[model samples]
Target: MERESSALLFIREKSVGFTARVALHEYKRQCDGGYPAKLKKVLIVTAPLWFKAPFRILRLFVREKLRERVHTVSAPQLGAHVPRASLPTQLGGQLAPDHAAWLEHCRNCYTNNLQNNKLDGVIDEYVISNYIPPVKTQNGVIEHEVARDMTSDRVARLEQPDAMHISDPPYTCDTGPLRHTHGYNGDMKGGHIHSGDEDEVDLITRGTWSSGEASPGLSDEECAGGGAGESAGALLARLRSLGRRGLVAEYEEIRARPPQGTFHHAKLPSNLSKNRYTDVLCYDHSRVLLSQIDPEDPTTDYINANYVDGYKQKNAFICTQGPLPKTYSDFWRMVWEQGCLAVVMTTRAVERGRVKCGQYWPAAAGARAVHPPFALLTEAVDVEDDYIISHLVLTDLRSEMSRRVWHGQYVRWPDYGVPGGGRAQPVLRFLQLVRRAQRTALADLGDAWAGHSRGPPIVVHCSAGIGRTGTFITLDVCTSRLSAEGVADVRGTVERVRAQRAHSIQMPDQYVFCHLALLEYAVMHGYLESADLNGFDDDNEDESE
Candidate 1:
């Protein structure tokens, strides 16, 4: 029994019968975990009513051998493999499905560290690290509550195996329902959150201004000199003259051209297929290549990332996707390999009821998550109104080499939309904070980050790594160009970025937002005044195009 390894997925027809999509997504999420490495086989026993349902689509994502691990069997078939005395009665076994009793047993295991302080055969401090009691809220009148009893129950039962392995400190109460019911934080209510349904109008809703003469900064040739010494009034007047519609038209012209380089082909077959979209690729010449962990194969070395050059600084960013559950280790590997000083996350891990990115780092101070040779420890966290700054230490367990990496999590900015109106100020402020930290790190640890005085290409990522990611980098590059050289070239910068990484600035609105945001930056820095910022309708911005 100690040597035997197995995993089970129970399908309660009464619970997930109608919602196949949710079931499949949940299944994929399970598959995304590190279970395949430990388990020799995974069994699926559905409710008696469920027929041999089509679950073959799952094979495409998992490894070829791991796919063979999955097996769908009936209740009677389960009894043949397991002793009736130990099996649950709900699935034709003698032991009754006593979840309440099971919870108590599991709680004891956590309360008393067993199996050499390793819970459920997995060695990790996560279960016991910072156990908190459930939040108790008394009922209030006229309160709106999303009833989640059924969903909560399903999750509790599904995770019973792993839950039994929790090894933590003393319990708040001796008895009660485990105090923890899966990882749900009560934000999402039903089904997978789709990004498509979100209201882009929640951002600044502004109208299209008539296209007049283009702004001096809009033209690549004119901007070659710089926007420096350009007065606040004059800058706003120039921006107002060019308008959103004209800038957007110019962006489309750049987008229409076929990408210049072929560096993106370095992506491996597996990594390419894993990407949410295909067109998003890393340009070959400037791509941030991952040092292969395995010498024999180079396919796995591919991480959908690239080295984007800053306005003046060469190789300013290691732009990549928001880490997937499977790519968590790889993402950290890239960070360590690239010698990055800071990680700037522009999108929330989950946004607008959808999983925009995986939760790649630890949630609190003193907590540690190990991705094999790399162990990420959250040393400290500073939560700002517009962004969260986490102090993380990455220790290479094998060589014992360690490095501190900063994570600037900006949550105010919507997924595909700009931080509009008053919101724009926070973004500018956030960028300053990130740059300040990088500068300070460079000055303090001079020789440690020797070559990267401007700091190693700060790892910037959103969901797709191109849309919001590209916009943020563009802002950083152009803003720096304006400050140092006195010019900000939207067309030139966007084209250069897309050259390194494909389909960079995602939509027309994002393209327009870049110009508007640059104008906002000018106003914030005294180059433009608040009153001078006119002809800008915060509510008239169009996303339909």
Candidate 2:
């Protein structure tokens, strides 16, 4: 046996038991006779912290060359050694694992070997020598094309001519100018423009709004002029003029013209308890309908969530209330059904002596939480000063199919208002982190969403799902629009969002914060000069208090 080809071996920590350890030690003893020439590296992933010392001790017993080849790494660190695009989701990679197709490939290889009279009652080596991994299709179906080299008694790699054919172009973070429209399409039906009627007055105060007095920022004169073709500098100047009071007035003007979309499902008596807030409802036109868990009860289909459009991507987010204790299962169901790879949580479980959001996920890493049909395992957690990043694997109990999900919780936002004092730097930094994680998750999806630059909708929620949720989404949309188009249209973006998600950017303070956030982002990214924002620090100081 030449054994000249190199190989990489991946082992999951959970799979290594006492018996496996004994077997591994036996193999190590055998390696003393002569180490295998095939394996170039061995990676043990998801290793517990306690295992580190043992692994070091074990390495000391191995041959010097072999010790250097063996390694242990966390899931996030694995991408540095291997390309994430080629790895499976289970390993924190883009590819979805297909064990059934792999087994089928092994079966074909075994059958071929037996027919060729090469089995000799030992099919392991023969199968290994001839197995071909299945190719994943755009729809995530596994298809195999096996070609055998009879003369060499080995499997031949098949070339896929169309492997590089991506239905949608890969998204790039370009700051120049957009070649197309960058916000919501505003095509949702069943919505009527508000006529400032008495019936609509109560709708303006649906979700929790800040009670703090408005902080001054932009001057009234500076806030007076704004239109579609305004340059980035002009937009920043206008944002600077729109002091807290001006922004509040602008928000009230927007609220007066509310696009009141009906929420029949949300208001249904059976579904009323599912909603976190009585008045904050998902619109009929864009609600995320769940497949009924009970075929006899149609009420099981309702969850208080709507699909909000993103810049150039329709249904880019599932904006919903934070899961109530009773609706945790429904929440995970929505996650599983929609193929959401990330969850952006902007509020804590409890705020200001009240429960703001439910503690739906496991409390600590290496713990499990069962939500009926689905089980979520918190694989790892990385806590930062401003946010906490959770790596979770959600497994379907019935089907045994699992998907990795990233849960990012922004913990620094005030209970009463938005983040970043006045500049919105903290919130913007958190947004950057979320976007990077989302982009990586989208890429890992491996073309499941063939034609969309933004993949499956990211689940965003707060207590009421409108105030903080809307502010976060609005910041994302406006900044993305600014990045792609070289212009920021805060009013237009909020209007488009409200058209889908009614009452988005609930408070005038949040509306003002969006303008400040966009202005800060523009100046930071060189879209506008910092000099354009002079004297804004005084306003930010006032807002901070």
Candidate 3:
């Protein structure tokens, strides 16, 4: 069977050498051999020069497609490096993230030969001269905006069987004398071509991989007044010629590696009203956390949301769940078993065997709460059943917690060992806790919780109950049908958890933060790396290794 293809996308790579090499490899392969058949005008699709890796790859992948006239599409249009800044008008060109980076890259690189319709043997002949989608510029400010003439000229470069569509360069500029301006903003007021408002633009000067190096083969005649120090235009032209070569040529160094998986991409459900307050929508994680505890059914059955929105009743006794148990679980279990069940509220893991059942405890990363901890479990001790309780002794507990947090010592974390963004300490810690909790749940229930118990042992894990508990649900979702975007139907996780119990991880960012934290830790430790993906290949033929 064919293996699953990679959906891994490159946000960008920091390697200049890699990008340039790849671009050149693609370009040379493209031009080196082929039928003597005619190849029409081509559109170059690239990541905003600032977005180096993905753009380079995107550019290479689309070369053949762009060579097909009329329907050509440029690199920036593909959404690989989306412009965060909005365009000024219908015709304005999109903003690049960083101009300086782009310039620096251009300085040391050679653009593709077909750029900007440069028929001559010049490197930057393809760099678009006209800016598009205008912006307002001032005398002293550097701005990013695509020019109208540039866009029209780009369209004009396209050809059809009957007629050629083209635009004449703005004849108003000082073309006769070949004179240039120094750092004049692209505004029309004082010979500057304006794109639009500054507030609307994001700075691309910093994002572009740029340098001051001139194109390798410019003649002294061509290099003269070449903006070494004279004018931005001269400098821009010089660098652009280089940009055409490749990102490696454009960017001096690209720190190549992997993607940061700390972020979770869950679009808010469309069911939400635009004016909704707090407006946070959780997946199965949140729902499961909220419904795991039933104050009424002390013997069994964690309370679930009675309705679609939520349930209103309370006072149910239920076994609670928590983020796959760790420092927090140990703390709760020790305290609960101490015969403090009445005086101190205690929430215990559900069914005892599942690792994620501990997410019920509502606690943050810090010192113990002044209010005595509580543990509530759904497993009812029948009149005949035996019970093994837990207790906590504070013997220098505060000091240990302190050492763990501030001193960066080996301290226990839930599902994860520590909270910081490095190492797999957290995951290892979590795995340990979950395995323990699951074992305990199963032994106590005699295999009842996975669905044999006459009444499901009320797994009650608590506090506000939301984020932590939701982690389990998220995991379940992840293990389900995976998408190319690295997303899962976590809402389903929450819904399933809600069916099991009430009042799961109640705090926001807890569920999201927990998973992200674990992932961050995994990523930093080299445990997780974006796999080489084949998703970007729009071509029909398989690429050779």
Best by lDDT: 2
Model 3 global lDDT (CA atoms, 0 to 1): 0.26
Winner of 1 and 3 under TM-score? 1
lDDT of 3 by residue, 289-374 (tens): 11112234211111121111111111111222232332343333322221112211122233235333333322333223322233
Cα lDDT of model 2 overall? 0.62
Lowest summed lDDT over 10 consecutive residues: which window, candidate 3?
A: 207-216
Tens digits of per-residue lDDT, candidate 1, 121-208, equal: 5422323222222211111111112222223454565345433212111111112222232211121213211111121211111110
Each candidate's lDDT (Cα)?
0.56, 0.62, 0.26
Model 1, C-alpha of 94: deviation from truth (Å): 60
Off by over 4 Å in 1: 1-235, 263-267, 420-422, 530-533, 536-545
Off by over 4 Å in 2: 1-229, 531-545
User: Distance (Å) between predicted and true CA of 280, model 2?
Assistant: 1.5
The local lDDT score (0 to 100) that residue 19 gets in candidate 1 is 42
The candidate 1 region of ten consecutive residues with least summed lDDT is 207-216
> For every candidate structure, what is the RMSD over all alpha carbons to the true structure, in angstroms?
25.2, 18.1, 27.5
RMSD to native, candidate 2 = 18.1
Winning candidate number (TM-score): 2
| TM-score against truth, every candidate | 0.55, 0.58, 0.21
Ranked by lDDT, top first = 2, 1, 3
